[model samples]
Target: MPQPRSHDIRRGRYSEAGRSYLLTTVTHQRRSLFHDFHHARLVIQQLRRCELERSCRSLAWVVMPDHVHWLIELKALPLGEVMRRFKARSSLALHRAGVPSQRVWQAGYHDRALRREEDVLHVARYIVANPVRAGLVRSVREYSHWDAVWL
Candidate 1:
């Protein structure tokens, strides 16, 4: 299969600071690397670190077996940059932590920018309820790798 060009992958996409976005990205080849609890926790740490680094405020997130969904309010950086750094940092940390991977994530990610009037809490609920929707768990409380401020 031919790999997509980077420019084509990011075309028609624009990132602005201070906007809330829901981002989703998969692992390389959709590997179930996050099935391990510790590895998934590492990703959660990096998600919070992105907030600590002033890139974005993590509103909600979930770590599935092969992908992640992150809802964040951007601080002063482009969403693309924030994601780039977040992925890179997490990949590095995971490697250093003795987690084996040829690559930590796929190159492109999906982002949906929220309008001012949109219900953020609704989105947060959707994010945290992914496990239930995926049949991974019977209840949100049973999911070990998801979080939302409202929950």
Candidate 2:
């Protein structure tokens, strides 16, 4: 289970902190907005900001053309609040950066909680190799919008 679906989170389920989650959020209307380097950088900035805020610690991440996949460890907040902050702040930052004054990410994100016995390295590999899976690059090194703490 990936921390329940978006609807479940809204209904007050699986809001636990101090867990690892693989999160995915898409652009509004599935727009390829992040194909633009500036917009992508804005999202990266928000990710770092989230880490600095201590809501979550990013373990690995990949900013795709129309979506993002982030592996993180919740530190000081529930997943819902963390996601809310990320969405809100990123939208505001992007708007300030002249991307748009409207919503940037979709209403909800998908999150998968990792198990204690799970191999995190495998998950990190999956997250960082998304570009290759999407045919955006032939190798992980060619993708600039991805990072893995373990790598």
Candidate with maximal lDDT: 1
Q: Per-residue error at 73 for model 1, in Å?
A: 0.6
Per-candidate TM-scores read 0.93, 0.90
lDDT, each prediction: 0.89, 0.86
TM-score of 2: 0.90
Model 2: per-residue Cα lDDT over 45-142, one tens digit each:
88988899999999999999999999998998888888888888878878888886767877788888899888878999999999999999999999
Instruction: Kindly state the number of residue pairs that clash in model 2.
Output: 0
Each model's Cα RMSD: 1.4, 3.8
What is the alpha-carbon lDDT for the whole of candidate 2? 0.86
Clashes of each: 0, 0
What is the clash tally of candidate 1? 0
Residue pairs clashing, model 1 = none
**CA deviation > 4 Å runs, candidate 1:** none
Candidate with the greatest TM-score versus the true structure: 1
